[model samples]
Target: MLSRRSVAVATMFLGIIYLAFISLGIPDSLLGSAWPVIRPDMGASFGFAGILSMVVAGGTIVSSLVSGSLVQRLGTGKITLISCCLTAGALLGFSMAPSIFWLVLLAIPLGLGGGAIDAALNHYVAENYKAHHMNWLHCFWGVGATLGPIIMSFYMVKHNSWRDGYTAVSMIQFTLAIVLLVTLPLWKRIAVSREHERLDSMIPQDQVGPELKQPAISSKANVLQIKGVKQTLIAFLFYCGVESTVGLWGTSYLVGARNMTAETAAGWISLYYGGITMGRLITGFITLKINNRVLIRCGQIIAIAGGGMLLLPLPQLFLVGLILIGLGLAPIYPGLLHETPTRFGRDNSAKLMGYQMAVAYTGTTFLPPLFGLLAAQTTIHAFPFIVIAFIILMMMSAEKVNHILNNQTKSTGINC
Candidate 1:
């Protein structure tokens, strides 16, 4: 059993990690929620937002691809602190940017910081925490996501100031970064305690030192050759495609298709993220009763139904559809993350987490821009159909992964 002091240290460290995640999420929705006003202010075309988004996503893809190595060298605490500072700087730069060019450049660091934080914390939580804790950790992320738009909406409604929104969030990031620095020693203490505890038998025997670094299982290429890895990566791709596309374009769709004011649209978008927050909170409890696969399948079905509702002409359906979609999407990402150590081995989970997140960011990078082109050629009405396509692809890929893992289990009498 852990000593009371060890338990206290672990709990404190986990709390710090959770706060870092909030910092990770604050900037995510800022651009999307403020884009309508921003477009008019900068005299940019509607589709230009996608270009900006693509730049950010590209940076994230690069960062995520390399995060495994970076984390091994620097440790999660240092990585997280450095990433937060980068994002804080980038966000502050965004608030002062005079043109779209400057905004595009600033987005690079923002994405890099975000991707590192995401990969590091996700791998950490998946390895150390239970299924419910994973769900709740992501629920806090939902809190930040939900707050982003609300913050933007408040500024837009009251002050007509998108810059102020970005500035406020940047301040929040900076403050969290400071908190992370002060508590850096706690991460080390907890890691050492847990390493000594060997809390789970599944923890790789190869882990060394308080940092918990281990040599790679094999080349990335070899890891990809594992059964179900490709399917899992594909599922991640389309899942993030659906999510990023929604956040990047949902406000535009609200204004262009459904004829809502920017402020109002921002508020409604917050409700969408609010659904995500509440859904994940509930799903944390639900995971005690249901396994990850069932929750994932159920979420996909509900999301598909929500996409159908989005295709309807009635404005009344828009909010309902958005909420449904948000709730539906809540479980899948965290569920998949929590499943990684079991699906692969704990030894491989860190490396796989990086690749999985890289592919996920690849989806974020390309899919929204593709839809932007589609919307530019035709109408924003294509948004729902595009979302439906991504969700269906994601669902099929996830099911295939399940089948592959199931077959492996049956054939070998071992969990894949």
Candidate 2:
């Protein structure tokens, strides 16, 4: 059992972590909404959006690759607090930026901050927190993600200034940074608790069960040697691609294929995001009873069913497909991460999680653009078909992960 102080510290730390996740998301959707206003004002073409996005993705990929070593050195709290500062600073730059050159330059720090904090917190929580909190944490990010666009929309219509929206959200991040700094002691307490557990674990071999953990996996090279790592990475990659492609292109598909008005398509896409948020909310509770693998597989099966609806060419059924797709996509991200500690040892999962994140963001960066080109060259009608192809790839990769893990577990004679 945890001491009273330890439990209290854990509670406070968990709350801070959730708030950090929300901050992580604030800038993610902000640019998308504000782009309409930001573009013309800076005398930039629409193609500049892709250039800026790639810059951010490049920064994220670099940061995520190095997150394991950084976390080992500085710890999650320091890294997260500093990351918040970086992003908040970038947002301020966005507010004051006089040209597209400044905006593009600021995106580097924005991506670096976002990636570091994301990988650090994910591995920390996956090792330390419960299944429900993991799922709920992502839901909180959805809250920030949703809030970003809303803030932009408000400033656009009310004040006729998108810059003000960036300023306002920057204040929120600054506030969160202060809270993190004040609660820095909580991370120290968590560190102490972890050290004590490690010492206790060193007490005897029999008491702690099998010595299955490989500490050398703390490095990226060794972590890749862990069973199912590559397959899991592939699964995450395709999963993120499927989710992004669908979410980004679903509005267009609705417009071109279903003949819906732009306004109606926008509303339904909003509902699709709502479906994701709501589904994660529900998933947090359901995970209490169901197995993790079962939850993941069930989520994919349901998503496949939703994808089937899209392929049917039925009118008004596309809305149902959108919601179903959102609900089905909900649990997979967190659920996959939740299984990491068990599939690989706790120490190894830390590195693997970072790599998983890097690969996932890579998918977010590249695959959607590929589909965009394909859709442009052929027809927008191919959007759903492309999404479904990615969905199938994700499923097959997941199956490979399961197969590898199951065989490894059997060979070791341990339950996973």
Candidate 3:
């Protein structure tokens, strides 16, 4: 059993992790929410916003691909601290950006910083905490994502300046960076205590349960060679595609196709993210009763229905559909991530996490821009079709992963 001190330390560390996740999400929606005004101010085309988003996503892909090595060397705490600083500096740069060129350049560090913190915190939580904590951790991300548009809209409405919004968020990021610096040692303390607990829980091989008898997968083995790995990665890619496309273009779609004001569109988009926040908050409790697989399937179905709703002409349905998509997506990412150790192996989870993140960002990098091109050619009304297609692809890939994992478990006599 953990001593009271150890439990306190662990709780405190988790609280910090939650805050870090909030910081991680704070800047995500800023570009999207501000793009309507930003494009005109800079005399840029509507599709050009995708270029900036693509740059950010590209940088994220690079960082995520290398995050495993970085975490191994610098550890999660230092990585998170450094990432926070990088992101803060980038956001500050964003505030001063005079043109789309500068915004694209600033997006690079923004993406790099975000990917590192995301992978690091996700792996840490999945390794150390319960399924509920994973949900709640991501719930905090939703909080930040939800707050992001609200913050931007506030500044845009009150100050008529998106730069001021970026500046305000940058200040928040810098503050979190300082907090992370002070709490750096707590990570080690919690890690050591958890290690001690794990060691103490070890038992003789003869007494080990059947579930524990499976040999560890070698970390050196190519993770892509694993039976379900490719499918899981594909699922991740499409899942992120669906989410990022919406985030990057949802406001634009509202303004262009739906005839909504930029300020009103920003509010509606915030509601979409708010749905994610509220859904994840509720999902944390639901996880106590439902397994990850069930939650994931349910989320997908709801997302599909939400996408279908978007096809309707009624504005009321559009509002409901947006919220439904957010609620549907709330559980899927966290569920898949938390299940990594089980579907693969604990030894492989760390490396696989990085790969998964890289692929996810790859989707983020390319899909929205591709859609932007398509929208430029046709109309923003194409948005719902893209969202629906991505969700279907994600669902198929996820189910294939499940099938592959189940087969492997049956053949190898290892419980996943």
Candidate 4:
């Protein structure tokens, strides 16, 4: 059993990872705030800006896959440390880059580091921590996401340069990285013993002789079955699409379509994230009381309703629509994350998270660019329609997944 102190330390480690994710968002949020100014400064066309956004999304997809493999090889702790360092370096590079090309190149490391930290930390917490901890851990991410834009907006309004804003965020990230590095040894000592024992138990005892022999069960073979893994992966892929599309594009829609100022748009964006924060806290309280599949499906319906509201002609409904979307999305990611360990076993959670994250990042990569392209060609008023389509797809995919899980539960007598 994990000791209380060990669990607390692990949760803190996950919190550090959330800080890394927040650091990733600082660049994104700052870009949203600074784009109009920076675009003119850089002499770039709107098409170029759209392509640049795609480039960052593309890097995220690639890095998510690469980091997943790295985590599988090096363990989460080492990968997280390396990711944080790379992320900080990437931010510094962004601060100093002389050209758009250089900025795009810097995005590579930023994406890699951010993707790795997200996958590794998510897997670690979902597998090892209690369910409530998973919700709370992601809530920290919501806090960071909310703060990043507000901080950038403040600096922008103060007549400070974008470089200063970027640099400030980088310094904060570096501080978190340092804190994580200092605490890493303690986490490793607590975790490694359990990992080794699990590894040892996987070996064939007959080949190692009587001393190595232990209880005979088919747990390993059963765990290796890939059918359910494929189903879950499909569910996660669309879920990623729904989640990232809303998050990355919603601010732009508000700015471009609704004629809100950048500051106002960002403020409204904060409400979306704020709703997520509150929703996750509520999710933490209710998950033990409610069935997860039911909660997830209900969330999708709420998200669809939110998306539909965005499509309506009423201007007053926009904020309410976004809040509904946030509440709907809040439970899905963490719920899926929390379910992984039970489905695949704790030992496989890291690699599974890596794979799932890779798939999810593909959605993140594909959707934003598509939205950007569409927004570039047409009015941003069309944005809500795109979101609506994704939400409906999420609902359908989740239903399939729930059905699959239910059938599996019936067949195997397992709760997953």
Candidate 5:
């Protein structure tokens, strides 16, 4: 039996996992900050930078699939351990790479580890933790993401070297890896409980003993086969596109097109991420009363408004717009994830999340490169329009999804 204290300890361990991988965002945040330093050091072109991000994104998509399989084979606890080590190794490699090609090569492990950590942790949290816990779990991700750039920016200002900043962040990840390893025993206990629950759920309820009434057989089937899975996946994909496109490209647009200073651009970027953090925290509370579909639709509108603000000529209003955008996007990811197991059943939650993440990472991988290519050709100002287009598509898809889910609820007489 897993004690409440044990579960709390496991939650802390998972929070450390979020902290570990969330630090990965530091590299990206540093890219803009260190552009001048790194470009001269590595002789990188804009196309090369785009390719590097593309490589990471591509690797993440593939690795998400691989990690999903690993989780199935090794279990979430073991997979998380492997992922932590891989992430540590990748960051260490990235910190020391002498050339851009070497850095790009290192991106493979980084993606694998990052994607694995994300999928496994998300699965664990969704399975072991309650619904409110899911919100706070993702909130930690937001916190780590927000801290990444700040840490990088602080180190860059102090050391005047991007390498040092990366190396420091690498150390932090290494420390997290050690912490995760130390907590492995407790995780194993939780895993056993989860598996037992799974076994119990698979047996017929009438045949089940009183102790096994609450079974854990969360089905691992693809969302398409499940009644509500298809609609959830569709909403999830569009949400991923909108969230990633904006997160990756917004800073570039501010600096390159609007000609803002590095400091101002960084502050704006902070606002964008901070808004996400705030939204997640608030949504964690508000979700108790509100339907997720309603929350998601409201988020879509807010994202559209934020994108619109950036598209306009008012530079002064950009920060206000970004906050709205962040707030809007904040709920979509966690909402969709929380709804997944509920819609599809818990047996296959990890696999479903893996596929969901793979497709979503695919969006993150491709769309950013497309935005970069567009910026290279026309102007960074055009990037917001791309975001707008995606947001519109996401909203339409979400509306359709809401309709489908509602009809399914009526047909099956399921409350969700």
Candidate 6:
């Protein structure tokens, strides 16, 4: 527990984390909204999205895999501040890019910056904050996510310029970086406090032999050795695919398959993210009385129902489906993350989280384009059905993970 003075410092840093999370969202949603306009201006084909996305994903995967080492070396404070500044710089590059080449070139920093901050903050929050803050932290991200499209829409509607949206977001990110720099000391204090706790909790030398003192495996390697890790990884991977596919294709499916207008579809698409944000806002209250496992199970059922809605011939259900899907998706990611530290010991959780993010982003990186190919070969109507398939797979993976962890909890008398 924090002393009164450390508590005050933690409070300040928590506020800073919220801002950094917001900063994370600002650039993330900007691309999807602006791409419709950007694609045409850059003279790129429809398939160009895969290229750019692949590049970004590649960068994200690289940074996410190495995030553990980076955090150990640079500390979360320096990593967060530096990554935000890099992302801000990349955003500025995006605003000024005259061609698709420049955009592709800039994707490197954008992805790296985004990945590093994401892995670090997620571990930081899970290790330090309460379950409710995990939900709320993501809620703030949803707010930024929701705002990004709205900002782009305003510029698109008014000046027909997407550049202004990027510029505005860049300024916000830059401001956050400076704020983080000012609050650097808080990160140091909390980090030092965490290290002391870790050391003090270790076994005394008298209790264990030297041969048994050190782990046979590396910390990073031990992540995979955890009993339920495979199932957990699969759950996370499918979850990312399901969530990303729904968000990315919802607009195209509405416009092409349902014959909705682009403007209307864009507006409707925002409902998905809005539902996610709203759901987290509500989940914060509910989790006070419920366990993360129960909440996750409930979310999966709701998501399946939402996916079922999309399979109908009726077009109006699309919006409702998207909203429900968002709500269902809202709790899963954060809840799983919140469970990590306790499920696998705190020391191992950091590397596990980094690997989780890497795999999750890998799903995000590849699935949509594969879905795109599916849509191309079949029909746009396949979108909802494909989403349904992913949901089912995710549910199955989740069940396996539940079984594995529950058995461990029972046999070992440990609460996962």
Highest TM-score: give the candidate number. Answer: 2
Tens-digit lDDT track of model 2 for 1-416: 56798788778788889989888887899988898889999999988988998899988988888887788788888888888899899999999999999999999998998998899899888877777888999999999999899998998899999999999999999999999899877876786786676567564323433323212223335788876788888999999998888878888888988898999998988888888889988999998887667888888988887887887767667679888888998999998888787677776666677788899999999898899899899999887778778888888888888887667655654533
Cα-based lDDT at residue 394, candidate 6: 81
**After superposition, which runs of candidate 5 have C-alpha atoms over 4 Å from their true positions?**
1-11, 14-18, 24-32, 153-160, 191-223, 227-231, 248-266, 308-319, 372-385, 413-416
lDDT (10s digit) by residue, model 1, range 234-278: 999999899889987999999998999999997887788777789
For model 4, residues 312-331, the per-residue Cα lDDT tens digits are 66877877899999999888
For each candidate, the alpha-carbon lDDT, in order, equals 0.85, 0.84, 0.87, 0.72, 0.72, 0.83
Model 2 scores a C-alpha lDDT of: 0.84
Name the lDDT value of residue 289 in candidate 6.
82
Candidate 3, residues 1-416, lDDT tens digits: the string is 79998898899889989999987887987887899999999899998876887788888888988887788789889999999999999999989998888888888999999988898888888877778899999899877876898999999999999999999999999999999999999887787787788789877655765433434455655888877789999999999889888877999988998899999997887788778888888999999988888899999999999989988889999878999999999999999999887677877777788889999888877788799999999999999999999999999999998776666555665544
Which stretches of candidate 1 lie above 4 Å from their native place?
33-48, 96-101, 149-165, 195-221, 248-269, 309-319, 375-384, 414-416
Candidate 2 residue runs with Cα over 4 Å from true position: 191-220
Clashes of each: 0, 0, 0, 0, 7, 0
- For model 5, how many clashes? 7
Residue range 151-234, candidate 5, lDDT tens digits: 767767887777777787778777777777787776767766767755665656567443223323335444457655565566
What order do candidates take by TM-score, descending?
2, 6, 3, 1, 5, 4
* Deviation of model 3 at 83, angstroms: 0.9
lDDT, model 3: 0.87
**What is the Å distance of residue 1 in model 4 from its true position?**
5.8
Q: Which stretches of candidate 3 lie over 4 Å from their true place?
A: 35-48, 96-102, 153-162, 198-215, 247-269, 311-319, 375-385, 414-416
Q: Weakest 10 consecutive residues, lDDT, candidate 2?
A: 208-217
Clash pairs, candidate 5, are 197-216, 198-216, 218-346, 218-347, 219-347, 219-348, 220-348
